[model samples]
Target: MVPQLYCDFLQPDTTARHTFTVKPTELAYINEHLHHLNHHISNLIELRSALLHRSNQLTSPTYIVPHEVLSHIFNQANQMEWRSPQQAIVLSAVSRQWRQVALGTSKLWERVICQGPLKLYRDSSLLIQHCASYASSLDIRLLEQGYKLGAADKTFDTTTTVLSSSDVKGKLKALELQRIPSPQWIHMLPSFLRLESLSIISGHHPSVDLSSLPLSHVYLNGSTFDSLILPPSVLVLHLDDYFLDYAVILLRKCPRLIEFSSETYILTRAQLPPNLSNPLALNSLEKLVWYPAQWFMELASATGLNIPVINNLELKDSEGLKPAPFALLCHQISASLESLTLTYFSANDDWSIADLRHLFTFPIPTLRKLSLTDWSHRLILNAICALTPDEGEDGYTDRCLPKLEYLSISSQDEIFGLEFDFDYRVLNLVKRRRIGEDSPFHLDFSFCSDDDADYEAQAAWQPELLHELKEFVANRPVTITIKGGEVELDQLSTARFDDGDCSS
Candidate 1:
C-alpha cells in the first residue's frame, strides 16, 4: 500500500506547506524523489530477510545421511589410499553450519589409519581411543620403513615383547602386518586374542613360519617363513613361496587345514620329508593350491587320502612342465571337485594348449569354474567349446554347466610358456607361423632370450604371428581372469588368471 504522505507529496499540484525556504512546486519534486528512494530500499530489505529465513530452516534440524551410505563411505575410507583426507577437507568447507555438523560427528573421524600423512597409526592405542566402543576390524601392516633382514636369518629391529602393546580387545576379525619380527612374533601377536583372519605381509623381509599359531585362517607372504612351529589343530593355512619347505610341516601339523595356497614355492627334493611314520601327512586337509608352478611330483605314491571336501584345484604353467606328475596327482583329488584350472604356472614345456588337453581327460561332474592360461586358455576354452556346441541340441551346454557359476581363462603366459623352457625349445614357438598365412599382424609373439634388456630375443621372428599368439582369446560364457600374479611352484597359481573372479 502506498503511504498517504507519499501520495499527497508526489502529486505535482499539491505542496509541502511546512517548507518556507522554497516554493510548493520545488517542494513537491523533492518529496517525490525521497519517496522513490525509500521504496527501493524497502524492497531490498524484504528480499534479504526472506533469503536469511530460508537459510535458517536448512541449517536447523538434524541433517543426516543414511547409515548405509555412511557405512559405505567408511568402508571406502578404510580402503582408500589418497581419498580419505580429501573427503574430510571437502566436508569441512561446505559451510559454518555444516562444519559444526561434521566436527561433532565422532563416527566420521574414527577411521584411524596408519602410514597416512597425519601418521595416526604411530600410536594405535590412542587412535583406538577415538574409535571408542564402536571399533571394527583393525588392519596394521608392518612396513620395511627402517629395518632390514639379514641375508640368511630373519631379524627384527624391535621385538614386540611387552607383548601387551600388540594385545587388542574386541571382536577383531582381520590383522594385516608387513615385515613381521619373527615366528615368535606371530605367537606374541597382539590381535591373536580373537582374530578370525590374519595376513602377514613381509615386503622384502625374510619369511617367518606360523605353523603353530591358533588362528583359524592364515595368509602368509613368501618371506614370512623365517621359522614356523605350526599348531597341530590349525584349520586353514595359506603359504606363499616361503612355506614350500613347510608343506611337510603342514602335512604333519595342520591335519584339519580346510584350505591352503602358496605363491610360487618348490617342493624340492631337499625338503622332501623321509616318508616316515606319518607317511601320509595333511590327511585331514581339504583344499590345496600351489600357484606359479615350480615343479610337480607325480605324487605317484598310491598313498594319501582323497582330499574329501576339496573343490578347487589351480594348476599353473609349472603344472604343465611336470605334466605327468601333476595329471596323476589330479586323479587322487576329491571326486566332488567343483573347479579345475590349468594356468601358466611358469615357462615350462612352452605351455602348449595340446599338451594340457592330453593331461586333463577325466570329466569332473561337479566342476563349475574351469580355467586355463596361455595356450591352456585355448585348450580349456576349446574343451568347453566342444562341450558346449554352438547349437543347444546336444547336452554339452545343458548338462555341462548345471552347477557352474563362473569360468575364467587368462593368457598372461603367451610370451613365456606355462612350465620352465630349457634354454632352447622356447625358440620353436617364435619360429612357428600362425595357422593362417593371409593374416596381417604387427607385434612379434616369438619368445627370445634378450640378455640384458635381459630377455632372450627372437632373431628371425614374424610380428603378425606373435600378435596373434599374444591376443588370441575366445569369448567363452564363463567369467574369465586372463591375468594373474607371478609365482612359480608346483601349483603356480598367483595364477588365478583362470580362477573365478575373487575380486567380487
Candidate 2:
C-alpha cells in the first residue's frame, strides 16, 4: 500500500555507512506521514471511545447506578485502605462517563502508593497529574527503584515540589519515605503542620537533624543514627537499631513523651554513659517497649531514666535473655505498670521458669493485662497461679494482682502440643478471679500456627474448648475467649486503631 517515493524513503540502504542519514526533504516527508497517521489514529480512538460509552450507557448496570452510589463503589474499589492508585486508573478507563466520575471523586486520589521504583520514576509526571486534584491530605510511599540519573532526579524533584505545594503543606497527614537515596530528602520536606506520623525506613546511614517539625509520631528503622537532636514537638518515638546514648539523649529532649519503643543489640553488654549516673525521671511517659530482652537490662542500668508513670510495657526478642534484668525492671516499675507483654522470637530458651514464678512475688499490684506469646504451659500456669497463692490445709492467703481484669495468652499450637489442658488452666483462672467481684474478668487464650496445614486440627480443638469455656462462664460475670490459629495479630478490625497500634 506504499507509494514509490515513500517505499524508496523507508527502505534501508546497505551502501550508506552512517545511520539515520536522511536528507531534510526526506525527514520532512516522514514527519508529514507520521502526522497524518497520528491524526487518523486519534480520530479512530475517539470514535471507538464514543461507541463504547454509548454501548455501556445502554447495557451496563454501572450506568443505572446513581452518581453518589457509584462514587461510593469507586471509593471502595480504589484501594484507599492501602493507598493504591492503579484501581482508580482502571475505573477511569471503563468509558467516558466512568472517566469523568473517577476523576471527579476526590477521595480516590488521596493516596499515591507506588511500590516499585522504576515504574514510579518513569510514570512520575503522569501519576502526579492523576493525584494532584483534591489531594488535601496526600500519603506518598516511594520505594527505591533503579538509580538511573535522569529518572531519579526527575522523580525526586517532582516529589519535592509536590511536598512543598501549598495544599500539601496544610493537608498532608502522613509521609512514608523508604530507601530514598538522598538524606537531603529530609531537608527538602517543608514543615508540614498537619503531618502527625512519619516513617523513614532506610538501610543506609541517615544524617537526620529533626528541626521544629510538628511530628507527634516518628519511626526510624535500620538507620545508623549514632546521635539524635529531636524537637520538643515529638510525643511518641520508635527507634530500631540505635545506640543507648542516642536514645537517652533523645528522651532528654522530649520531656512530654508518652510512649517510647526501641530495638538494639547494644544492650546485650551495654555500659552506662558517663553523664547518665544520676537519676532522670520522665513522669509523663506511660508506655515503654523494648526489644531483645537485654535492652530491658540496659534500660534498668540506664539509671538516668525513671519512667514512673509507665504502665504498658512490652519486651520482645530472641532467646537466651536472662531473667535478672526482667526481675530488676519489674521491681523498679512494679508499682506503676499495669499491662505487660512478653514475646520470644525463638522458643529455645529456658527463660528460668522459676525466675518467671518469682516475678509475681514482687509487688506489681496495679498489673491487669498480661500477654505471654510462644511460652510453655508451665510458664502460663506459673503466671496464673502466681496471682492466687496456694495454701495447705490451713487457709488461702490474699492473691497477687487482685485488681487484674484481662489476661491474654498466645503460643504456637505445635509448641504447646496436645499434652496441656490450656482450656482447664484458663477456666481455673477465670473461676478464681470471678469469685466475688461485681465486675467480670476477661481471659484470651489464643493458639497460633505457621500455616493452614494444621488449621483443621486447630479448628477441631476450638469447638471443644469453646463448649467447655461456655460451661464455666454460664452464670458468672466472666468472659473467656478461646481462639484458634485464625486471628491475625497485625490486622486491625476497626479504624479506632492507629497505624502505630498495628505495626510490629
Candidate 3:
C-alpha cells in the first residue's frame, strides 16, 4: 500500500541500485504524511495507557470500597497497629487513592507516637503538625532517648514548643512520657484541659500536681509520691515499684477509685500512718491488686482501711505469704469478692499445705472464678485438694470455693517427682464439681514442660486421662481442658468428639 516516493525514502542504501531523483515538493509531501502517522501512533499509545489504567481500577479489590469505608478501615488500622504519625505517611504512600483517603481520615491522625532521639522528634514535628491539624482530640506519646537529655537540649526545647503550641495543648487527651530526665515539662500539665489519662514512667520522681486537672486514669511507674498530688476525680490508679507508704498515701486521697493496682511494693521499716479509731473506708472500691507482703498486712491492720465492696482481688508474688494476715484480708472482703487470681507462687518452706488450707478455711461463698498461674505443682495440688470435697460420714460436701464456676491453673515447669495421680485428682475434682450443676463448669490446666523425659511421660498418660474425662463429660455442661508437655488434649478431644468417637 506504500507510494513509490515513500518506499524509496524508506529503503536502505543496500537496496538502492540506481540513483532515483525526486522533486523537493514530493519529498516535503512524504515528510508531512510521516508526521501525521507519527502523531496518530502517539495518540494510540496514550489511548492504550488510559485503557490499562481503567481496567486496573475495575479489577482492583479495594476499588469497590467507598472512600468513607476505606477511610474507616484505615482509622481502625491506625488505632490498633499504627499508633504513630509514620503510619500515616506509610499509608499515604501506598497509592494515590489511599493517600487521599488516609490524609482525609481525621481519626487516622488522632494518635501520634514519637519515640527515640530528640532529633527524631524534631524531624517529626511537621507530621505532628499535620496530625494536630486534622484531629480534634489527640493522644500523644513521647519517649526520650535512652540517655539523659537535660532541659537545655535544643530537641527538648523543640518538643516543649510543639506541645505548647495552641492547637496541640488544647486538643491533647492522653499523654505518655517516658525516661525524660527533666521534670520541668510537668509544669505544662495543667494547661492541657482535655487531658484525661496520663502515664509517667521515670525515675526522676518529679513533683506533679494533678489536683487542678480532670484526670480520670493515672499510671506512675518508678516515680515517687512524696510531692505528687492526686485529684479526687481519678477512677483508676496503677502504682508500680513504689513504697507501700506512698501507695497508701495516694489511696487515702482517691475515694472514688474503682480499680487500683500496686505492683512490687518496696517494703519499708518506717511505720505507716497511725491507726485511726475509725477505718478509712473505700466504699466505692471494686478491684484491688497488690503484692502480698507483711508490711501491707500490717498497714491494713493498723489503718483499718476497708474496701467493703471490693469484688476482684489479685495477689502477685505470694510465695511466702503468712497465713493469719492472708486469711484476715480475705475474710474482710469475702462477702463481696467474686473473682480471685493468685500468681507467681513458688515452692517455699513457709508456704506449706496447712498455710494454704488455713487461708481458704474462711468461706468465700460469693467467689465464682479462681485462677492460679506460675505456681509450683505441690502448691497447685494442695490448693485444688483443699477445694475438692471429701466424702463425709453424712454425704459429699464441698470444702472451699463451693460456688466456683471457673478454675484455671498453669505452670511453666515440669511436674517433676509427682505421680500421674495428679491428673487423676484433677479428674476427680471436675467430676465432683460438675455432677448435678446446671450451670456450665470450665476447668483449664496447662502443665507444659520442655524436658524430653517429662514430655514422654506426659504423652503416655495424657491420652488415657483425656479419653476418660471426655467420655464422662460427653453430654454434660462441663468443659475440661488439659495441656501437657507441648500437646493440647483439648484439641485432640475436640477432633475425636467431632468424629463421634469418645472412647479414643
Measured by lDDT, the strongest candidate is 3
Order the candidates by lDDT, highest first.
Answer: 3, 2, 1
How many clashing residue pairs appear in each of the predictions shown?
Answer: 59, 1, 0
Clashing pairs in 3: none
Residue-level lDDT of model 2, residues 1-504, one tens digit each, is 111222123234333454556687567766876776677676666667676656655555354665445544444343333446644434654766656545655655666655444544556434544566655556665555623424247766676676676676777767777776665566655467677777877556445565666778888786655444667777898988776766677777777789889887554454445687657667788998887666556656666458888999898863557777667778788888899888763545655446766776667888988777655445555555554445431112355566677777755535445655655555565555453355567666654444445241221234455465566567766654444122232221221222233223
The Cα error of candidate 2 at residue 307, in Å, is 1.3
Ranking by TM-score: 3, 2, 1
Evaluate residue 56 in candidate 2 and report its C-alpha lDDT on the 0 to 100 scale. 53
Instruction: For residues 277-361, write the lDDT of model 3, one tens digit per residue.
Output: 6566788889988875455566677778788899998877764567777877888789999998888777672566666766675
Scanning candidate 1 in windows of ten residues, the lowest lDDT window is 473-482
Could you tell me the lDDT of residue 422 within candidate 2? 53
After TM-score superposition, the amount by which residue 196's alpha carbon in candidate 1 deviates from its true location, in angstroms, is 2.4
Stretches > 4 Å off in candidate 1: 1-112, 116-125, 132-167, 181-187, 203-214, 224-227, 231-234, 265-270, 279-286, 292-305, 345-360, 376-504
Candidate 1 lDDT tens digits, 312-415: 77655554355555655665662667777665544335534444544444445576555654443233334333333233243323333344444443333233
Please report the TM-score between candidate 3 and the true structure.
0.73
